[model samples]
Target: MGDGLPDLPPLFGPVFALREGGDALARAVALAPEHGAGCFVWVRAYARVEAAVVLEPEQPLAAARPALLAAAAAMADALAALGPPQAEIALRWPATLVVNRGVVGAARLAAPPGAAETAVPAWLAVGVEVRRALPPGVEPGTDPGRTALEEEGFDEADTAELTAAWARHLMTGLNEWQERGFARLAGRYLGWLERDPAQAGAARRGLDSATGDLVLQRPDGALTRRSLRAAVAEGVA
Candidate 1:
């Protein structure tokens, strides 16, 4: 590889470059237990960006959901920084990232399977993938629901720069969560969620303070909740 990803914070450990077609998330997961924490793995795919980082946390697995989500936010922020002005970046609940209302990519989290909610996982991996360019023969606007960075005027953005930016932003996010609180991280994430004014009043949505679950209030005062942890776990599988 040797694209020379930019220098990251000291706490981010070392970068492991994977050849094209390599799975960054799987590599990070396999190396995490041995590397302990802070190791990052990335692959510069032909038309996409993929990367994952290992994390070792003192808190229980349940409480760590916010940290994983923060990583996703960091990735989104990094892309936004490099993307064209008014790119209209937004995040779907839990992990998906959209630009200009088109699905560009998503983030995912993985931990020791069947680990108890209150137990500290041996390791946690946060993975991110973004579409860098449309595949050959694919035309823009062919699928209004899907898009790539190139199609969105992000010609200046590249996988290596995005990888470096993500690391820095993730470090900042983790520090914010530790020093300030999850509320601070949560506010940023909530603000980026795609919202519709038409849904206001008739029903409302918010995040649960403790578990990071999506809480929806119905018109009849009934409440429904969806766990972000469960969402991440499912995505990992």
Candidate 2:
């Protein structure tokens, strides 16, 4: 772990910084069962980054989806705070984060393999990674659909600062979820979802608080649901 990490809130035990090429999510997941919750790990790989926090929930694993979503929303809020006023930060369904309409980062959730949905796992991990700087020899316009923080005018926001901000914001988000209920967190997350203007009138989409599923409703009264848990299990975005 690296030094000089900002003071974290009470819920987060310590900030463990992984060396170059280290996988934060993998380390956190491996240690979670033993260390339990409040263990946060992060890695600052050149232009890429990785982070994960361990969580221990009293509720069953199936009911823990809200916690994961709240963590992702907190991360989004952290990025939004560091970004310029006009910069657009949004979530792409379950995991990806879009900035200025371009892909910049993503979040992931993990638990023990084959852990029963109805049983609380020994531990859970929520990991996130964002591109801090452009890759070498990569021009701004080379990949218009993708972007890095520096390329998007966030030159002052480095990986360390963002990681610290994420910890603080995540603490706030979890507290709000506990006090105000999941609806409040869900509403904030929904606001950050990107939507196409042309399809705005075609259907309405929302997140199911209970199961963390994407619910879509059409004008014809047809409803479709996509499960976040299933996506996590299948390792799909």
Candidate 3:
């Protein structure tokens, strides 16, 4: 916590910090192989909260992938704690995160090499970036479609504190998944997930426990699925 650096918990492995221009996600992925589980890497940037965590799962990739949802849920929890009381935050299925209707952050996942849906991955790296503040001279609400923590009334949202909060929440979410069940984790995620107001009664969304896919159920019982594995392949979470 000194000098406002991220203070990671004891359960985590080695933690690395990158300069403003470095990519936290890429570096974390690179470290995942050698550092193994619980390795954390982050960029101490001026305008965003950027970080990633390495994990080794006991379950197969399919089952382990729900960790992405846990990460997303963790982000929402982390923000809520530091943002204005009762501030609005939502998860856009798969990866995107919204703050007061503007895209503020996102999470991405990386599966280990040679990983298959049924295989237990050697490691997985989950990276997240949140707009902490705009560069000096940038005006808030200049673009309604994008936002940052400072612009959203999160006066107490220090980058280091927020990052530490996220890591703690992520660990708690995963532990709940392992001990209580995926249902436990899914509930927290779904609670923060965004829904189409126009199609309120026309569709429903649920997560497939085994594959971590998003299932959109139509009123007529027709279902559309979004693959978590596919998102990992496409380089997003």
Candidate 4:
């Protein structure tokens, strides 16, 4: 499949393709310990655009939150590059992409549970899937919030092109994350967050000093940390 397609972009040079389809997550996790870092796996024939990146673990997986956030920010950057206007695209907190107010796709990250963050991880995988085409016979307004690129008039974007663009953006994000800090990444991500009623009456939108979690400070001076982990687990912001 990908053989007949055009070449992948330069940034994704380390990609490896799988011949059989069993479990991409298992495959990625199994291979991560060997290749170490920057190893990627891509499956083109599948229904989704899937890939993974490897990272060494230094501390426990829970402590790896900042790195996970960095990877997520990287994915958001990748999606933004394909837009008609750069930075106009953004991700809803907890892993949803809202492009021009429409859902383009989603990104998922994985690693061994209880793995260390500061130490080289056994392996880390970040997979992204974009709906290039809609299920046949599906009509608009049937699902107002759900959409594919084809439905939104992005006919020019093939899977390969999107994959390449994502790879480039991801690398840029990771580099920036390592060089600068999460402050910039967090700022970019915060700009794209969709407003929710749960955050009304807060001193600020969602700023928390403790563990960098989003918090709501009421007029009564009560501060509660908005559980981003729970939000991510439920796939909502």
Candidate 5:
């Protein structure tokens, strides 16, 4: 705890700090059923913000999947505040964070074993990590298509503050989801979502309300759906 990850806001407590090698997602999943909600896991690291939080959803796992979208959008909100003005923060589909068009990091989700799509999950955990800098030998811009906060003019970015902000924003987003509906959260998420590189602007994409799938609407109005469920099965990251 010496590295100074700020204390998370109220409601996120029973904080569990782990070693640099800890997997926030895995640890949170292990703790979820016993801890219930508001359990937090912060993976200690200097070059990255690695953390996860647990949420107990009232809805079924399938319908609750957009919680990942909400988490991603919350991250977008958190990064927007930490980055320099004019820095573009966006999401690539479900939960990948993009800053100034570089792949910074991503959010991933997990549920208890045997949690069915139709049955309410015992608990859901959303984990996120964003790079603060490149590894030792890699020079900036020497590596294309990826970036970290330091290289992107995030001079004021602090992993501690970023972690705090992400949690608070996530709280706010989940609150909005409870007050309004998935549409509200989905719209906010999709607003910052960028088109897939392979099909940029070739179609308009939106989140499926019932299931959090990525729906692409072609100019001709034909629709193609990318299953979020399948994506999660493959890997949410």
Candidate 6:
């Protein structure tokens, strides 16, 4: 692992720039106990950028959902720096980044296997992967489900610059969460979600602080509590 990356904001944690052979998640998690929170593991892969950040396990993985959302918002800020056209970039719940209405990449998260509530946690890690280049013969909209920066007309950008920008934005957003709490992060993320007309009947309610669930009250006097845990486990909003 390499270190000493300047320009990455301090809250991103310690920087561990990894060679191609390293495992991104494992590398970040390994540093948690010693490096403390915000330790970052950035794995440089050809044509793709991947990274992971350490999350201390004071609560179950589910309880960290808000921070997870904050991470995604930070990535959006990074992508915006690439000069994506206005309104061209958006994030799909629970963690997919979309460009021009096509999926460009997604975020993946991992915590200690079988982590339990009240367990101070080994650490949680959130990984991000963005495709920079496309393989030959794979045309945009070929999948109608995926895309890349190059395909999106972001050829002027490169992985190094992009990764550095992401580290900064992510750290800044994390700090905001640390200072002000998850409500701020939730507001930003909730703004990105596409409202479902079908769910119009489900009165949009706020998250339950006690259980960390989103409670939707229906117009018909019915109430539904959706577990933030289950939503995050699937990793989609």
State residue 88's C-alpha deviation in candidate 3, in Å: 0.7
The lDDT leader among the candidates is: 5
Candidate whose TM-score is highest: 5
Report the Cα lDDT for candidate 5. 0.85
User: Model 4: residues >4 Å from true position, as ranges?
Assistant: 1-13, 18-26, 45-47, 57-60, 85-88, 116-120, 201-212, 216-222, 231-237
| 3 or 4, greater by TM-score | 3
For model 1, residues 84-183, the per-residue Cα lDDT tens digits are: 8889998887788899999999887888778788888888898888888888999899999999988888888678888888888888888888889878
Task: Flag the better candidate by TM-score, 1 or 3.
Answer: 3
Per-model clash counts, in order, read: 0, 0, 0, 12, 0, 5
Q: How close is candidate 2 to the true structure, as a TM-score?
A: 0.91
Candidate 6 ranges with C-alpha deviation above 4 Å: 1-6, 20-22, 57-60, 196-226, 235-237
lDDT, candidate 2, equals: 0.79
For candidate 6, write residues 43-161 as lDDT tens digits: 76667777888877455455664556666677787888875566387776567788777777766677677877545467778777777777678876778778888878886667767
How would you encode candidate 5's per-residue C-alpha lDDT over 1-237 as one tens digit per residue?
324667677888778888877898898889888887999988777799888999999999999988888888999999888778899998987689999889999989988887889999888999898888899999988868999988888888677788888998999999999999887898889888887765555567777878999888888888878888987888855
Q: Which 10-residue window in model 1 sums to the lowest lDDT?
A: 195-204
Give the 10-residue window scoring lowest on summed lDDT in candidate 3.
1-10
Please say which candidate is ahead in lDDT: 1 or 2.
Answer: 1
- Provide TM-scores for the models: 0.91, 0.91, 0.91, 0.76, 0.94, 0.81
- 1-237, model 3: which lDDT tens digit per residue? 123566677778688888888887788889887888989887777788988899999999999988888888999999988789857999887778899999898988878677887888898888788988887887887888998888888887677888889999999998899899989988899889888553366467788999998788889998878788787677665
How far in Å is the alpha carbon of 163 misplaced in model 6? 1.4
Q: Which stretches of candidate 1 lie over 4 Å from their true place?
A: 196-205, 217-222
Task: Specify the poorest-scoring 10-residue window by lDDT in model 6.
Answer: 1-10
Q: Point out where model 3 deviates above 4 Å.
A: 1-6, 197-200
RMSD of model 3 against the true structure: 2.2
